[model samples]
Target: MFPKHVRTHHRLHHGHKPEELDFLIRRESVSGGATSSQMQREFGRLNEEEKENLLKGVGLRPGIPSGAGLLLKANLALSWNKLRHLRRWLRNWNVSLDSESKDREKAKGMTSPLVAEQLPFTFTVKGPDGKLATEVRLASCVCLEDISSTVLQRLDLLEREGKLTWHGVIPSDEIWLKIGGDKGGGSTKAVFELCNVAHPNSIENTIVWNIFQAPDRRHNIETAYKINLSQINALCGTMWK
Candidate 1:
């Protein structure tokens, strides 16, 4: 005999047997499309031990369709396989892109020219006492050694005319050209050719060379001699301040 509550809940209150009650519940779960929440509520009405015993006895549980669960699991596995394939493809694409970029750079380097196009600079000669001796414009491309010799020749011409006099060695081997500014980096080994130097602030694109002698003259004159070139543009003139 079925319990009164069971028969009432199953809508078989007209004194149905236990087998009829089970059949009604099974039919409600399978054919009526009962949800997981509804099944849980119905299952909760049974005692804990009874619920366990029933779960063991009935392999085909109620609520969710077995085929639906299997289908969902298969879909998830397929999605994971697609993701792994996409990741591998992206990695291969990146490697190919990097290889192409390196090849392009190598080709460019091979085709580049070696000679400097223009050599324009402004020169400032300072005496041992840190006084500005003269300022001249150089519009030719000459090596650092040639530039030093030119500066010495100019200074000699000035001395002969009684414009300036030096008590020490007339063309001191210590004389050297400092490129850029007063900031000293002993010597510049790199020689640039046919290069364009652009200074954002000024309109005059001229390299500044500060020619001076080192304070200590004991070192080898050849090794101590250093020359650097800086790109400092001349200031532009404007009427409107």
Candidate 2:
């Protein structure tokens, strides 16, 4: 049985209750990252299950994430956080890689030309495993009128590619869809980390590629994207090892 009864939704916002804080202190002991020997002593005070629950909450398993995987995920989470902060700078510099409809109306009010463009809309195809198979976009341009058809065809192509990608558009298993809306920068980064875990290797590269490969990136280009594709490609090769 799971040790802690706290539902994830509550824990996320409120953190463990006072009684539960002890669980965190205990779990940190057995795990290798603990900084102090005092933590090891503290673990003796808690029941075993409480210790397990705390570790699980932080995504630590005895061997599952692997030491390297945990470190990579931690670093990736940090990088993603940094990326979110750049949005203000990106907005100032005119980067419009995200959905632009909101900006269009604002621009219309000020009589500014719609600085963003409508082009072949590209988005990542996320899988149930929550990892990305391949970076794919609508095989052709998509506008509201033809979006349905383009989405269908694109999924079909993705399925044919087969080795990594999948389709049939199951909500639970597979699907063809565009990134719908911004759910705040922090939310987006959290989702990105889940996808990275789901997809693992070359996870960072795939994300960078998606942004770089987009048709209309006008402002706030991340300088990281300027590195050669071949160099980026090399990272993918080493993802799993």
Candidate 3:
């Protein structure tokens, strides 16, 4: 008799719990970012014969998300640790892009705005004077890449023009990307590593969710939206590699 249990699905799936059907559900969800009605069709695709094998616990898991994808989902989830990351993910969008045509001959061109609206993000960088600079507002759709380029360019131009020795998030020889929020001289926001804070629409989304909320007596944590920048003055001179 053929064995009831065979490690047949391992080639297709990994790290999945056999008993839990959430993997199946998530797999359907990821299939072209399936809609609710369409994904319901996956409920009982496993036939009786297939379920018999599954019952033998000889299969791997499915719907495993990448590390970055997991983090994005976790942070955006509604929880007490509600991090205000500002970006809309296409994964959660209602419609499927796959529904459109890839054939240039058959498909008509279309465009959609990255975000439905814009938000204002205010921040400050520290100058060599050991004091904080004035408020700099990124008053529209902005991302981490924009921040990196804009901050670097603005600082370089200022220094080149003898504006003032700015010693902020710009990494020096020793320190790299030292920036945080609540920069009225001291940082009260969490010290975000370069990798941690690197994201899209983070600047604007955070501001919209965290700062643009209805004014309330208990609505605090505006500092969570804060991005203060500072660095050791002498650890590494502006001599970058």
In terms of lDDT, the best-performing candidate is: 1
Q: Report the C-alpha lDDT of model 1 over 1-241, residue by residue, as the tens digit.
A: 4433343354532466888766666645453434356668778999977886776577533333323322332344334345445435644433112232343455454232222222223345897899986443323221343333333444454446654422354343232222332324432222211111122123222222232322222222222233322121111121111
| Order of models, best TM-score first | 3, 2, 1
Pairwise lDDT winner, candidates 1 and 2? 1
- Candidate 2, residue 157: CA error in Å? 19
In the predicted model 2, the residue pairs found to clash are: 95-219
Best by TM-score: 3
Task: Write the number of the candidate with greater lDDT, choosing between 2 and 3.
Answer: 2
Compared with the true structure, the alpha-carbon lDDT of candidate 2 equals: 0.36
Error of 2 at 120 (Å): 18
Ranking by lDDT: 1, 2, 3
lDDT of 2 by residue, 45-89 (tens): 779788866666776534322133223333565453444454345
lDDT, candidate 3, residue 30? 54
Backbone clashes, candidate 1: 6
**Residue 215's lDDT in candidate 2:** 33
In model 3, which runs have C-alpha deviations exceeding 4 angstroms?
1-62, 73-180, 183-187, 190-231
- Which of 1 and 3 is the better model by lDDT? 1
